[model samples]
Target: MMISNTPPPPYYAVIFTSVRTNDNEGYAETDALMSELALQQDGFLGMEHASSEIGITISYWRDVESIKHWKDNLDHQKAQIKGQKTWYSQYKVRIAKVERDYDFLKK
Candidate 1:
């Protein structure tokens, strides 16, 4: 799902970029679960994701603390382990503060 209702600027964005391995055994299920769990997190703003040769999932949070909490979440940790072992070939995570943002929507 596309996350449209993002909060106003000055939030945090965790940009997860990954290259997948051929073995995708349980990737989809785990990914869906992670997204579901993130929504339940305290400072979650929203998320936008896309996948192809390289996959990118950008999750927005209220602050760095919230992002840290999500990173250390037990279930998420497990998913990380699984991704390291099976799903992803390589990945990079970058967190940045959204200083300003503007968008135009076509009706």
Candidate 2:
């Protein structure tokens, strides 16, 4: 996935790290659906994701309210339950405020 184009260094980021249980049932579809659904939310800024031995998905938000709104989404909540019960062997969620960021690209 490409890096997310965020406006500045004032947004919030929900960092999700996970290790899977090798149970792929319903995971890919639900993950894609959740990403699409997040884009439809009020203050979703952008997202970046990657997976390997350890997986990391960072979703950017406009503010704490936006993050909370996502946390309350019923579909996402259901996914969370399913993940706990079946998908992940272990996982962690971290929310942090962005204070500074920098990047560059070759022209």
What do the candidate models score in CA lDDT, each in turn?
A: 0.92, 0.95
Residue 71: error of model 2 in Å? 0.4
Compute the lDDT of residue 54 as modeled in candidate 1.
96
Instruction: Give lDDT tens digits, candidate 1, residues 1-107.
Output: 75557788999999999999999788889989998999999999999999888999999999999999999999999999999999888999999999999888789
| Per-residue lDDT of candidate 2, residues 66-89 (tens digit) | 899999999999999999999999
Top candidate when judged by lDDT against the true structure: 2
Return the clash pairs for model 2, or none.
none
lDDT of model 1 at residue 3? 52
What's the TM-score of each model vs. the native?
0.96, 0.97
The segments of candidate 2 whose C-alpha lies over 4 angstroms from its true place after superposition are none
> Candidate 1: TM-score?
0.96
